[model samples]
Target: MTGVPLLDPEIPLPPDFPNRMLTHMFASPIETDIAPSGTLLGLLQRGRGDGWLHALAAPRPDAVAALNHCVLRDPRPDWQLEHRSLYYARLYRELDAPLDAIGEHLFDPVDALEECEQRTGLALSVLGHLVTAGRQDALALLRRYAVTGANWRWALDELAVREDDAGLRELGPAILARFPGTEAGERALIEAVRDSFEPRPWHLWAEDPARSGQRERLARALEIGDFDRWQRQLRPPTPQPGWSVRAVLDWAREGYEQTPRQWREAAAARCLGAVAGPGDREVLLRAAVEGPSPVVRAAALRHLAERGDPAVFELIQRAAEEPDEELAQAAVTAYARMNDDGALRQARGWLERTDELGRTAAVMLARRGSAPDAPGVLAALRRVVRTRGTDAKELRALVEGSARLAIGPAVPVLRHIYRQTISSQLRGHTARALAVTDPTFASGFAVECLWDCEEETREVAAHHAATADARVLDRLRSLAADPAEQEGVQTAVRGRLAPS
Candidate 1:
């Protein structure tokens, strides 16, 4: 009663063992056959075909059940008891039975140690096998074993490799904290923490128990080796634990959504940079069309074309047809980087579909060889700037490069934006445009910019002034001496004003 003997009297404990393990020993070895249950067999197959027991090929479920029942009903003989008990343990693990159920019929640690004066070798073997099997139920069973500080070393080491990240982290730390001197104990502890943050690619699922830790693992993986692991893991396999395609997409979307307005633009940019694949193309296309931020939408549009996706051409055309000038401009920029007859035709068709302002934009973009110019492109650009509310900077910049091509009526509009615009930046740019045709016109804007309040205007003015006026040196010298002038303004004026 004290030692809680399990097998027949002929059966005895293996020689040379500690006593405490006997307390938790089984009294009656449970029955199991050479062949296990179908569920158990299937579980083994799923686990890379390795398991605690060798599976029987084409096993008879009835024979297995009969053998299992016989073992459970009778006390195993002395010589066969060790094998019998071990077999029972294996069956229990396979069937996912509770360890305490086995323990309740077996030895109790305190009383067994007082009477037996030796550990049960049978119990040790069962525990060791469970640790190595790495099955979830096996792990649960191993936790019930008599875990002395000495036994803790082997147990912790095995757990580090066989258990999931969370389990290893838990058991490994307990071993190290309780048995600081044992090398295996200490190593297991460190490995648990290290592997949590830097998981091996083959075993990401093994590390998912601690999601924050798993995230840390992913981040560390990205830094380790050109991110081949991240790229591989995140790619097709349809779905896997740590780096599934859909999960990554969702993660990036979440970040973009939660970020502050100022930061959302940057986050979306980074997300787009990281996410590019066939399936992701639609997501990016939708973002290009309907993203909340212009910056995000523009970048998505540009990258689609940059990625050399043929589908982007149609999307670009669709965006070009939108009433939003920003989207239209982005699509135009993307179109410029592309070369496709379809895109050109689409852009032209959309342009023809719009009224004067959009028509002018389309014609300006089309004239650059993007599409065949509508017979009316140049004339439309002129009319838009003259009578429409087109931005002067835009009209002038458009006219600057194209005016030399007998751009017709747009030339006068460019001159008008140049002379009438209030923005020195626009005026200076328009002036430079005019300089491309008539240097005198550029010189006039240059003088006007010099008298302007904005430093940028003065800089432009000085640059233009440097190209004109025989008395330029005198003008700069006089300006440099003026006490009212800022040092930067004086220096700029002096630099451009060559000495007589």
Candidate 2:
């Protein structure tokens, strides 16, 4: 007769035999009320049997699981009395076990930290002996323990020395509270606060509710000149509220001397809101002109323009000549907003330069197009669109300018550019431009580009193209038979290409 397999063929053996054996050895009987009711007898059964104790005593990594199973399946008062601390320590070790294996008892953060600290205290007593015995690895092991849990002060202090931002971030507020006024503690608090300002996803911001509190904490730290952490909080999307404008000004004034582009930008943005006296404008103006960051220069130009001084016009003129496109754009936009004749004259002069520079100058010029010179600038833009290559920037200028000018000449170029430019942003703009310039110019090119583009662009293109080009109907008919395209794109294309 053939013997049955010890394990069923369908139930494959675990890769680690010791863990599998430990698991199997403590497997309860089918009818064992091994549920809640079996606890008392399970404990009594443990002492009477060699199998449970032998499983616990096994010399393998799975030994921990077997021991826990023995204690949990049947707990006894005498067993606790005999091995209270040992059992607690072993259970603590399982806290670091794989997540599925981590028991409920090991999850109490406060209790785990306390026990870990106590174990560390006792372990340190033997460290001297180990050192004397030349156990180099022993020191490293002790160092690891010293850095774990509630006793993480030393690690934070060490991390601060190495300028480890992520490490200091992990140590977080608990270490901040523990170390208080110490330099490392101060630095950690500052870093924690500053890190809070980093641009996070909206979902992430909601998830990290403590981030607002962390920001407040960082702000308080800045008052005392813990500059490192104070500045950390100034990253993107964080609106730097006016705490002490004078203090921030002082820092900006000091910082701009050697500040990186990002830091100068942050400070310049802050100073813009601060009500500066006459001399403050000079400081800010210097930063705008010679500051390391173009963004900072842009902010400074904005600050000066908003100051209501006619002098800001000449300052902006100088900035508009700067090589940095973003700063020049800011200057042009600012000058347009002022709407003075001098500002318009400067904008027109700048428009005569490169297309990249001309784009911003044209936008400002378009806004002021009701002025006497507006028609000439519009004509120049019409020329640029018809003649320029199919780059995204030129396409955008063409499409946007055509919509603004409502010029018929832009129709062909916009259509051609839409077909050639790979950028979905430009493609969508081209469709809209064609619709705006002359809705009848909509054709197979519009439908083809819409099909070729992605979500937002496809939606925009379809909306304009279908409304204008009835021929998009045949294109949709052909697109329907194609299997390779996404359903969302096809559905949107169909919806736009549908009647009306």
Predicted structure with the largest TM-score when compared to the true one: 2
Tens-digit lDDT track for model 1 on 1-500?
01111122322222321332233322333321112112333212111111222233225453244323323333222223213333444444445544443333223444334332122333434454555544455465445442442333333443445566555445432332442445664454344434342333214432445546444443443344344445666786322222433444344344445646222333333445565667877777787777665555666777777676777766776777787676677677766655555554554555544443355445445345322363345545554554443343345435544444544434455555543332334444455555555445434445544444344445555666645544445546755775544577687887676465
lDDT of 2 by residue, 30-69 (tens): 1112211112222222221112223334454554454344
Question: Where does candidate 1 stray beyond 4 Å?
Answer: 1-245, 248-266, 278-303, 319-380, 387-393, 399-410, 442-446, 454-474, 480-500
lDDT of each: 0.45, 0.46
Model 2, global lDDT: 0.46
Measured against the true structure, the TM-scores of the candidates, in listed sequence, are 0.36, 0.41
**What is residue 351's positional error in candidate 1, in angstroms?**
4.9
Output candidate 1 Cα RMSD.
Answer: 35.7
Q: Cα miss at 201, model 1 (Å)?
A: 54
Looking at model 2, the pairs that clash are: 190-229, 194-232, 194-233
